[model samples]
Target: MATAAIARPQVSDAEWEARQELAACYRVFAMLGWDEMIYNHITVKVPGEDNAFLINPYGLHFSEVCASNLVKIDIDGNKLTDNPYPVNPAGFTQHSVFHRHLPDAHCVMHTHTTAGMAVSALEGGLQPINFYACNFIGQVAYHDFEGVTVRAEEGERLIANLGDKRAMFLRNHGILVMGKTLPQAFLMHWGLQRACEIQMATLSMGQPVHVPEDVVAVHQRDLSKVQIPGGPGKADFDAMVRLVDRIDTSWRN
Candidate 1:
């Protein structure tokens, strides 16, 4: 008989929170059918200084993620934590391009949901087709697809495409949105997802969809005022935590 050998990964408390949130984000997105298998990633800048980021380990389903599962890496893509989970270099390239330059970007959310991919395939990109689309109006950016995004050279192109916007539609790929806080990013993602859903449904109906310029302008103004009154935008965060609790509360475990 042959004996089996195994090695375990170690994660800390700080990394733990990052894992929980990342896992919850995954579970919620999976529940919504927004995951692109294990391809797309959601990364959160580690709290405080040190220039660290946390991401999913390569081979696991999002639903299987937990506080103990995330892998930490530095801006240079070096695995800094004591975890044996292999980091995806291409995934790091996709995420690090933003983290290195975008100081305001703390939580980066990327998804390959059906609606997002459907809209990405359209030559027009995300048009100002409706009010929800207006939330993305001038704020949306675009990145052209450059193969599988595995090359380090592609980082420059990704950065150029992202430019100065917090929301982007990666042509031939999917959607990416960044938030200063998790709730802000998550809310923006909700808008982006809803916009994609509307785009797909409307286009499938085989009818032209139109939004008056004046109406889009009005909603843009309304969206500008759409922040919670005080306290670190935790309301939406709490709400989402509750939603995660309803489905699978073990993310924190």
Candidate 2:
């Protein structure tokens, strides 16, 4: 329950840009059918504070999310802004633990996508069955289902479960991806969830797998390029924001 400082400086230009990117990530998650109404959340650390972040207001659907609609709150789940909307304590509990403990994790994105849940429930979590699957090699963590992550007591457990990892599979639930920037988190979540979907689709075929450890390791190294700043996936975030604008400009309103 770390609280943000009361007299912090105003949002810097870079942070303002991040807020817009994070909002677009939420909308793109919705567009990709990864959102569970307004139940899930994507949070980003506000500039200049290790314990402060911007999260979507609890009542708004992802489609209704706009940059201005995002709420600023402390890692302890306290709202710092003057928005009339109430923060979801349950979602805050889930997000705060990660932000409080992981200093490098600027953006934490979670979703209850069907494919993600399916993969989480499988006997093997994120088996190396596809090229995309290797992107998570030696990096993913798994947290047992704690019955919805609504209580403050769950925070410590969740943080420990996610220790030093960039991706987490909440068993019988969904996925979480942490990144240094909103765009990076969005890209990782995209790959993580899509990898799960690919695994599910391949399993449905019920045939022998083709993954080799050497091959997976190689692909994993190559895919690391996408995670680099200024890579194609990095550019995708800006493009996706424009895509959202094309589909529904009101998200900016």
Candidate 3:
């Protein structure tokens, strides 16, 4: 865990809360092994600001991230706050598109987990092979890999491909999820990761049992019931937040 050497920024209470939540998400991602070295991103729009948002500083491991260390940036990825940490605008170009174009897209996350990349490389692309996968039937969208996503022009095409879906499969790349809040996005990625894991496991054992279309449709119809109780992904994310706190609470600094 990182020490609290970084000074907390002067900001609104809502923004502070956003920063804490975003920082906790980084620790949670690190705890879950969803981190990819110093790469990957989970961005959240700063409350009461149209273009301002929070993201992980470049070159910091997820485990080293904290509320005070998160970099605040604008729609164009320019730093909006004073900080010694470096910001990688090009790295988060893909995330900016979602944050700009999508409604309620307060949080956008991307990951390069092994199972996620495996499923992305598959020709079928996230088939409904299990319950977790079934919940996203006809809801997940795919965008062809257009190299490192540094090009701003690709955003239009990616948005067109994604339509209104919250989950996206970055073909030959990895997985992406967006949400109105961190908890919702966290749960979405958790389900996506589990879906990929189970799908890979089942495929290795030869022909798997097929889930009838009717069952899949029913599952989709009732996915709301399976959501985090009392709020969208609230209980699930809060529980994980608790677990991460137990491991190391330094993320809140």
Candidate achieving the largest lDDT: 3
Which should have the higher lDDT, number 1 or number 2?
Answer: 2
What does candidate 2's lDDT look like per residue over 94-172, in tens digits? 8888788778788888888999999999887998877778888678999999796789888787888878888999999
Q: After superposing candidate 1, which stretches have Cα over 4 Å from the reference? A: 1-15, 230-233
lDDT of every model, 2 decimals: 0.77, 0.79, 0.89
Task: State candidate 1's TM-score.
Answer: 0.89
Query: Considering only N, C-alpha and C atoms within 3 Å, which residue pairs clash in candidate 2?
Result: none
Native-referenced Cα lDDT, model 1: 0.77
Instruction: Write model 3 residue lDDT over 1-253, tens digit each, in one string.
Output: 2333678899999999999999999999999999998999999999999888899988899999999989998988888888777766555688888888886899999999999999999998988889899988788999999888888999999899988898999999999999988998998999999999999999999987878889999988887775545678889889899999999998888
Worst 10 residues of 2 by lDDT: 1-10
Collision pairs in model 3 = none
How far off is residue 128 in model 2, in Å? Answer: 1.0
Better of 1 and 3 by lDDT: 3
lDDT of 1 at 60: 69
